[model samples]
Target chain A: MEFSSKLLEKAVNEMAQLPGIGKRTALRLVLHLLKQPSEQTHYLSQALTTMRDDVKFCKNCHNISDVEVCEICSNTSRNHKIICVVEDIRDVMAIENTNQFKGIYHVLGGKISPIDGVGPSQLNISTLVSKVKMGVIDEIIFALSSTMEGDTTNFYVYKQLKEFNVKTSTIARGIAVGDELEYADEVTLGRSIVQRVPFEISLKNN
Target chain B: MEFSSKLLEKAVNEMAQLPGIGKRTALRLVLHLLKQPSEQTHYLSQALTTMRDDVKFCKNCHNISDVEVCEICSNTSRNHKIICVVEDIRDVMAIENTNQFKGIYHVLGGKISPIDGVGPSQLNISTLVSKVKMGVIDEIIFALSSTMEGDTTNFYVYKQLKEFNVKTSTIARGIAVGDELEYADEVTLGRSIVQRVPFEISLKNN
Candidate 1:
């Protein structure tokens, strides 16, 4: 047996399955959790369960939210005409942390990666396009990462929504190659948004 | 305010407080849990509360167990005459993983660290001394780490148990410098237990 206790070993094995956590690291976490106060363990268990049970995808933008529409999408104060499109909800959180973007969000779930078999059809592209067709969307901002797949996805998205009569943009300025929006400091990301360009020219430069 | 969602941010912050898990790692874990079906979260939450609420310290040996006396302490196959003393329950779990020793365990709860204000009185050393005097215990093994403070605590335990006529031994000779028993692989550790020397010579030489 890799571990003596069945329950403890199970916990460690489960932990090791997580990204970036190896068997040894998983063992350390399980052992540490075993030593923690009962209250702390209880809190963790509650949090883990509640995270999924209490949260649901926002109907409009597909962002993980507690309510059906999500607070941002429901709020009339948010500029619904301007939609920020991102790879995942993590990007939405990253943009929200900056507190500069007054617009609501639409999470694409993932970027287009042909090698990995993640195509535009697999993502929330149709939802985004359909949202744009609502006619009130004056600007659809592409906030995808600077990776190759990100660029490919942005190009496809721009092409798919060109028939619509509105300005489609992307957050391009100041971001470097192979960078994620989640890791960029608030100041740089905020400045990048301020200098966002239209999809027609932004596609070549980005 | 660093997080867009207050509840999620609170949960991530709490997870980040765990050993080896930082902010980014915590966010990853929270997000991973959020993606899973609610059942997985329920399992984790239930396990946390059950581990805390169902398990209590064994009054006799101080080892964590489900019942009054731990499985190890209550077992007739295990040598009741020998008690392996350790700083925490993790040490017990480590030694148990080796399956080399049949003796019971005694958790000190903590070590003798004056800097952290952990003196001998704070530990369950008195209960250990009482066990030695009871004549049922034929041998007492110190299975703590090889660090300076671990050595100091071992010395303190030795002086207290010195008056007892029973054979006083310690599990050493297999571990290296700055290594905790919990981190040591099972094979090397099992070999170490077979090669433990007498407490007096072992503690002084190291």
Candidate 2:
């Protein structure tokens, strides 16, 4: 017989289904919660059910937000001339934590993974095109994953925005900064070689 | 501004309020739950609510249970004549894992600590005394913490049951079975010396 109640067993099973949480860890969490007072446990239950309720995605940037336009998109202080396009809201938070970029973000929901049947139509493309056509955009920094699908997504977005007079640049995928050449992975070395920049060709005196 | 919603914040707050959990850890847990599917989150919510609703304290031992009598108490295979008293259900679990003892358990709920305002009346002592008086008990072992309060509790219980003719013993407080003498703590060494057996007198070859 289980040490916990069936309800706890069910809850533990659900928690175990989450990314990286196993059944043992789930049991520990349930047991810990059980030791606490009823109000706290009730509050936790309420939050889990109500967290996604009444919450709408930002209509403008596709960031997970309660309002029509995300906070970043609505803020006038943010740079309107540059837009950082990303694959998910998680990336928006990742960039926001850096406190280095003042530009707003546009979430594409996900990349063009053909194996998963995710194509250009599956993403928020019409809105992006409309945003560019409305004119303040000078640069679009594509901060996407280095996966094959992300590259395919970039070309698709690039093709759609080529006519609009905006400079489109994708984040570089070569040897990482501070990496030793001898220990570098083959893929990185090959990409770095393929994307090599040109400078003045020097001839030896000998 | 945080990327989390109000409900998510509430859930994290509830989680952080649990013992040994902090704000950062709660945030990580909330994020993990958010990334999971709705079915999994629903199960976790149901579990939190049911933990209090379904699980009840076992009347026999005060261990957590869904039934009136816990599995251990109801089991006929267990030795009814011996009872091992403990502070909490966790202690019972620790002892059960050993599979060395076949006796029943009596949980004190908590030790007597005047500083915390916990006294004899707060514990399930009346039930324990009644069970002892049933004339079936032959041995009563006290497996408690080595703290001052635990000792005081042990002394009080021992005094209360002095009238009954039963084998009363405490779990040994000495250098542990696998401990290295060089690394033994002073308190453990002192206890071992005081409780020294007649090994030298009885087993001496000379």
Candidate 3:
């Protein structure tokens, strides 16, 4: 779209560079910023720039943090020996929300997607290998999504750690707790059946 | 959602303040920015802040501009005596794209909407009236949308300019170009029939 002012056009173009935002949406957002008080735009710009300049990652988990190490990684009560491998910081937040896992996380930053030109070397895999090689970890859990990229990353990391004396396991795949079994996909249903646990074991967990 | 980093949370919150963007979408956008190079974030922030701090509005028409007077308002070829009143710069851009109207525009900035707490005084209505009172303007066309607020704004402006000698009219309300008659709304179809133009007049325009 043609803009009357170069400044407006530049702002909209920059906003459109973001994923999922188009030129029209960028224009709308820029116009919204224009309509509001100048302080609103200042705050947004300041926050974004500050975050980009100062944001840090946990040295141990590779998750986003403001300090040298994240709270979960530094917490003495949690079991740091059991590392939960995941895609990004979002996954760490999701797992933390469940309050089920007491283990620390190892953020891979992203999955290994060759189609997108992202290889194993691009991710935070080397540090994780070194952590495992230190022989302080007891168990490693693969907590990535169920996509093909997730499986590929899991297998690649598992192969890298095979020579080392580390036990690796994947998160269980099953129908959602509130979902009907009839609606479950065939592959997931079949896997759930094959991986069924003992009746008493399930009772003991409850 | 819980964020490990305060800076990340602040950025996400600021991004979410934009219209139509929720917390989840904001988080996704902020994280995407983090994944990209620092220059991308710098450019985006700089553009938005510079636009907000330096952008100007045309003194005559109140359209967004970088100069004291907008290009359209300063153009000698366009008819200055005839003014088309619109809600915002987007409408100005839309009309300009059509290449039909040779008259200048007066952007109202917004329509009178009680629900949104927008009144005529808040918009650029006074300047338009003063321009009309100068006796240089021959005609004033109401080109706001056909919504209730648009109609209210049109009537309000019409009343304000009643004492002046300038002729007032509204943009025609009818079925859109290439729209099926069967699918047309009842009010618009009825208005189209009632305000039907002469057959020769339509032929001459084509």
Candidate 4:
């Protein structure tokens, strides 16, 4: 689409650089900003700039934080010995929302996607490995997704931690609670059946 | 949803204020930015700030421009005698894309919507009226949408322009070019039939 103003075109071009936003959506967003008070746009730009320039990552788990250490890592009540390794901060939020895990997290930042040029070194894997090598942690739970990259990262980390004698596990996979068994995919349903827990064990959580 | 960091929370809150973006989508976008290089976020913020802070509107038509007057308004090749009044810059772009109308445009910025607190005073109607009173224009084409607010705006402008001797007309409404006749709505179909043009006039455009 042709824009009458150069400034509009520049803003839209920058906005369209975002992951899922297209040129049309970028145009709509820019126009919406034009309609709003200038202060709204100022606040949006200020927030983003401050976040990018000043945000820090936790030295322990590589999660975003305001200070040197993130809240999860510094919370004394949580079990720091048992670290749940996940992809990013969103997964951390999702698991926290469930109120299921009592341990802290190790944010890998991203998985090992070979096609996208994301390798093990590019992620926060080395710090996690060094933490495990310190032998303070009792358990290391692999909480990454079940994708190929997730599996690859998990395997790479597991191999690196083989020298250390710590318990390693992964989050269990099963059909979602409200979903029907008939709608479950074959791989997941078969895995769920094969890895089925005893009746008492399953009933204990509730 | 809770954010792990205050900075992340602030950025997400600002992002969620956008038109269609919700908390979840905002979180996703914020996390994506965190994953990308800091320069990308810096560029986005810079572009938006510069656009909102420095962009100018055309003196004659109120369309967004980078200079004192917009290119379309200053182009001497276009018909200065015919003025096509529209709701916004997007409408001007759409009509320009058609390449059928050679007249300059007067962007009203918005229609008259009492429910939304918009009135004739909020629009760019006064300048259009003053231009018509100058006795230079021969015709004024109302190309606003066929909504209640659009019709009200059209009537309001028409009343203001009654003292002038310029011929006033509205763009025709009918089923879209590629739409099936069976799928056409009753009101539009009936109106199109009632306002049907002469066979020679209809065939001339094609």
Question: What's the lDDT for candidate 3?
Answer: 0.95
Candidate 3 lDDT, B1-206, residue by residue in tens: 89999999999999999999999899999999999999999999999999999999999999999999999999999999999999999999889998889999999999999999999899999999999999999999999999999999999999999999789999988888889999998999999999999999989766
Tens digits of per-residue lDDT, candidate 1, B1-206, equal 35546567767877787798998889888888776666666665665456546656788888765567777877898888888989877677778887778888888988999998889998899999898888788888888887778989999999998887878787655878679999998977998888776889767765
Question: Least lDDT summed over 10 consecutive residues: which range in candidate 3 chain A?
Answer: A197-206
Candidate 1 local distance difference test against the native: 0.79
Each candidate: what lDDT?
Answer: 0.79, 0.78, 0.95, 0.92
Candidate that would win on lDDT: 3
The C-alpha stretches of model 3 lying farther than 4 A from their native spots are A197-206, B198-206
Candidate 2 vs candidate 3, TM-score winner: 3
The sequence of per-residue lDDT tens digits that candidate 4 reaches over residues A1-206 is: 78899999999999998889999889889999999999999999999989988999999888889999999999999998999999998899999999999999999999999899998888888888888888899999999999888888989999988888889999999987789999999999999999999999989877
Could you arrange the candidates by TM-score from highest to lowest?
Answer: 3, 4, 1, 2
Against the true structure, what is each candidate's TM-score? 0.74, 0.69, 0.94, 0.93
Model 3 lDDT per residue over A3-121, tens place: 89999999999999999999989998999999999999999999999999999998889899999999999999999899999999888989999888998999999999999999999
Best by TM-score: 3
Docking class of 2: acceptable
The deviation in Å at residue A49 for candidate 2 is 1.3
Native contacts retained, all candidates in order: 0.32, 0.51, 0.94, 0.82
Please write out the lDDT profile of model 2 over residues B38-126, one tens digit for every residue.
Answer: 66667677776887678888788888877788888899999978999998766887888877789999989789999988999988777
Q: Quote the RMSD, in angstroms, for model 3.
A: 2.0
